[model samples]
Structures are given as C-alpha cells and as structure tokens.
Target: MRRDHPMPCPDRHDALAELALGTLAGQERSDVLAHVARCHACALELSELSRITDDLLQLAPAASPPVGFELRVVERVLACSTSAPTGRPRRRKRHRLASWRPAAVAALLAAVVGTGAGLLAASTTAGKAPPAASRPVTLSASLARHGRVFGHVRVSSGRTPWLFVTVDDLTGPGSRTVICEVTLVDGTTAKLGRFRLSQGYGSWGVPLAAPADSLRRALLVGTDGSVLASARI
Candidate 1:
C-alpha cells in the first residue's frame, strides 16, 4: 500500500479576508477553501470574515461618477510628478496571497482582526495567489506615541474608485478619529479618506480621489492635530 501525503498549501491564513470577499482565485483560493473544510479553526475564521464582509456591503453606495472627475485628478498627479524630487520608495514585502479584498472589507478586516477570533490559522506553503496587476506600491508609517501602519496602492484594487489604498497594521487606541492623506509629488496633499479605527485591528482599505503613481507620501492625522503615522508613497 502507498502512503498518503497531504495536498500542498501556502499562506492560507493571510488570505482568509480575500477569500471571504470573493477576491482570491486559482490554487490559493482552493487551498484555503480546502483547508477550511478540514481545519475547524479556519472554518470559523472564514465564517467570521465572511460575516464582516457582508455587513460592510450595506454601507456601500451605489452610484456613478460625474463626467471628467477622474481626469482632473489624473492630470494633477501627472503635473506634480514632473516637478517633484526623485527618491526611492521604501522596500515592500511581496506576498503570493491576495493584497486585500474590497474597500469595505478592508475596513472591517482592520477592526475585527484585533479580536481573538479574527486571527488566522497558521500555514507554511509557498503557492501564489492570482495576480491582479503589476505589484502595488506599498508604504509604511508610525504614530507619534503609539501605532504603526502600512498602505498599499492599487488603481484596480476595488470597484468604488480609480484609486484604491489598503491600510494595514494599525496599532493604538481603537476609537481614534483620524484623517488619511496622500501627498502628491508636487508637495500638495489630497485627502484619501477617513477611518475611525475601532477597538480591534486597525487595518483599512480606503478609496483616495487621487492617482497612486503620483503619490509621494501617506499621512494619518489625528483629530487633535497629531500625526499618527507618516508613510512614504
């Protein structure tokens, strides 16, 4: 008789959010799904993430954009990049797993991930997830007294807008009011969006009204006029 070996796996835990939001595909998706079927821990996690994603769906707006609205932002980013100083962006850690799901899911993923139930099951496989486009630009920042964050940029990151930013690894008070901003290469800032990080994980995926390529920095400013984290774009 031949011995049976388990199927190959990868970083399935990191992709639960993507899987719940229907973004993961190919072997990566299948592996996570399969693992969830056999692993009790993963199944519960999948259920929680799925429930969170469904809740955010209610807050999403259904509408179209005005004529030429995107054009203006694109033009601005282009204009600034031409006059901006050149510097290498910080090195980004590449992952074969999905970057993030949708914007709403990203926000929810950030908050709940701090809970004991939101932590993903551990796995050590080298398989890669489906590639969306060219690798996104990633940036990082830290709060003045406490907290740290990283942002991922993708134009096709989600359905709401042309600019998609995935903010992750936020640490600090859960109920802080903060404004996220993106600084253009030309030294002007554009508002990315606002996230009121609740008690839990502080990861958020927000839509910015600007171009990712022209962004030079990302700032998380508190309501009290303190910088939570400053990230290089």
Candidate 2:
C-alpha cells in the first residue's frame, strides 16, 4: 500500500492466509500486510502459520506424507477456496467498527469546547466590581478639608436608597459607627434612621421623599456633629 492509500482486502481471510504463507503477489501482499499490521489476532495467526511451515520444512524424508497426501491437500485447498465467498460478513463488521471512532472524537471535542466557554463566561462575570454599598452620606466638613466642593456618594441607586458614610479616626471602635446624619444642601436634613459602618465607612438609607436632582448637594455628618464628606448626586 502507498503511504496515503488504504490497501483493499476484498477477501480478507484468504489474503491473510496467503500473507502468512508468503505466497501472495505484489498488490495482494501489500493489502494483507496493511490489514495484519492493524489487527493483533491476524498477526498472531500469521506467526503461528509461519512456525508450522518452518516445522514442516524441517521434517526428514522418512517422515514425508503418504501416497494420498497430495489428494488430501488438494481437497483441503478446495474447501478453503469454497469458503472464500463468506468474506462479506467480515468486511461489514470492519466497516461498522471503523465508523464509531470519528463520532466519539467529535463528541469529546464538543464537550471540551462547551466547558471552556462556560468557564470563560464565569470568569468574566466574576471579574466585574460589585455594586456600591447602599446610600452613602457626603459630609461638608470633609469636602472643606479636601478643598473640593464635589465628593463621591458611595451609595447604590435603586427605588430605596441606603445611606453609606466614612469617618476619620475618632473616639470610636474604628473610623466607622452606626450613628450618622444626611443633610441635603436644600436645608432639609434626614436623620440617620439606621446605619452600620466598617473600617472608615458605613451605610444606611432613610425612606424620605426627595427630588432626584437634589441628591447631588447631599452632605453626610458623623454622630459628633462633624462632616465626613459631601456629594452632588
């Protein structure tokens, strides 16, 4: 067989037996060689036949066959020749066996690709920043300390806004406390209803009706009447 072309074995059994006996011609011999290379059972049978042939050749003249030996050999050869027509079943089985490999490979590839895509999506979503801590209080004193009228509102946006505040190191557990107040620039102040802070920051949201635009001038104050930060919306 050529490197690229598969060898044809129309009568696989006879080809295998001839290949074992080393009696096949050029193309037929190549075909049987290809088949045996890929088939362990055929290879073992070929090895056994070769050993038997070698042993027969080593027999002495006194051990030669009787007068009817040639006739018996011819009969056996005819019998094997008659059985050659049954090769179709073996060919069909081989074809069916070969068809499953590509299907299995395709299924494995699809699973790998699907798993990779899922992981990629998960990683992307996990990499994003979380929502800002609820309603944040902006203090006027902190904005004066920083020499800036504008500050950040660390609060999240929603139907009900929560208060979030950050305080400096004072006579408290940390720079954070649960007591704070939110005063808008419009002179309307909403007392800190309920709040909690960790590190230097805390949050709480009061159920008060205010215009969306007025939120920009909001200021957050600590419990000791000190401004923490201020924000415009």
Candidate 3:
C-alpha cells in the first residue's frame, strides 16, 4: 500500500503566497525556504502557485482603469477615516491602530483592487499613471555550447529588471556552484550572482542593476573558470 503525505500547514499559507509572489525576503524568506525544502506538501503547493503566477504574467493586452478611480478611492478612505470612532480608545486596540498607517491602508486597498482584476498594479503616485496591465517585456535566449543547448536565460524589463536562468542536462557532479554573469553594452562584464545546480538541473533569479536592454549577453561559468554556456540577451 502507498503512504499518504501530510497536507501543507495552515499557518504557512500566507508565507507561501508571499514566496510565490516574490515578496518574501530576508530571514523570513530563509525560514520559509528551509521549511519548504523539508515539507513535501509545502514544496508542491509552492510549485503549483508559482506556475499559476507565471501563467498570469503572460496575460495579454493591458487594461486601463476608469478616470477618477484614484480620486474615488482616496475619497472613500478619507470618509471612513473622518467617521471612525473618536471615543476613548481601548487599551487593547492601541497597537492595531498604531500599525494602521495611511500608506499601508492605501497599499491594502490597491492590493484588493488588483486581486479582483487578476494583476497586481505597480505602485503609483497621485497623478493618473498607466496600469501595468500587459505583461512586461521579456527577452530570452538559449544557453548553448558546442552546438548543444544546455540551458536558457531570460530578462524581464521593469523599473528593476530581473534575470532568470535555468540549467539542465549539465554533465557535471550531482551538485556544484555555478556563476551567472552579464556582459554590459560597454563591454564590461558583471557578476550577477551564483547558485548551486542540483543533479545538473536548477533555476535561479536575481534582480539586475543594469536595464535589461543594456545587457548584451549572459554567461554560465563553471568553478574552474570555464565558460559552460552563453546566451545573447
């Protein structure tokens, strides 16, 4: 008979969602990753959610919000703020009240609205800004060497560009450190970061300092300083 695995922990739902959204960071992210590494259920959920997120990013033709939408949202928030209870505050509620900053409230409202529309809008100021409705431009190239493709690299454009890499069928030991480097338009090479490949397969992502368009190419380098594969961005 086959054995059943335990389901993901209830308390980890929020953390997993944040991780899937690429918002989890610092020690919290490390902690969640550690747990997911050991918990098969959580890892499976993360993978499913991540796939869904990738699908969502590929949605076509952006949508624009109606005029006065921001104004109306701001008015509604102010209306509630002015009408909120002014009576003697409860001792137990002080902490909650203190945590409710205007920016946080606005962010929450934006998130709620974005969730209903299926795409999270980037942060905007008072003026009317274009909605990030369509998917960001993503440039991709295959990582190849000796006429054989071994991996792929992609650059997604935004205020802060991101680089994604995936490697497979690498002829190497089970696990080893691999370096990711980018060649700038000016001919200077910068080391983006490093990641460990497990059993010749792994994927990693990192934010890039240079604009995606400014990168000429990407390289995957082995520990012995050999160029394993290169991709033209």
For TM-score, the strongest prediction is 3
Query: Candidate 3: where are CA atoms >4 Å away?
Result: 1-135
Distance from true location, Cα of 162 in model 2, Å: 5.5
Pairwise lDDT winner, candidates 1 and 3: 3
- TM-score per prediction, in order, is 0.35, 0.27, 0.43
lDDT score at residue 166, model 1, on the 0-100 scale: 35
After TM-score superposition, the amount by which residue 107's alpha carbon in candidate 3 deviates from its true location, in angstroms, is 15
User: lDDT for model 3, on a 0 to 1 scale?
Assistant: 0.63
- Ten-residue stretch with the least lDDT total in model 1: 116-125
Q: What is the C-alpha RMSD of each candidate to the true structure, in Å?
A: 21.0, 33.3, 24.8
Q: Which pairs of residues clash in candidate 3, taking residues 3 or more apart in a chain or in different chains? A: none
**Which one wins on lDDT?**
3
Candidate 1 Cα misplacement greater than 4 A, ranges: 1-174
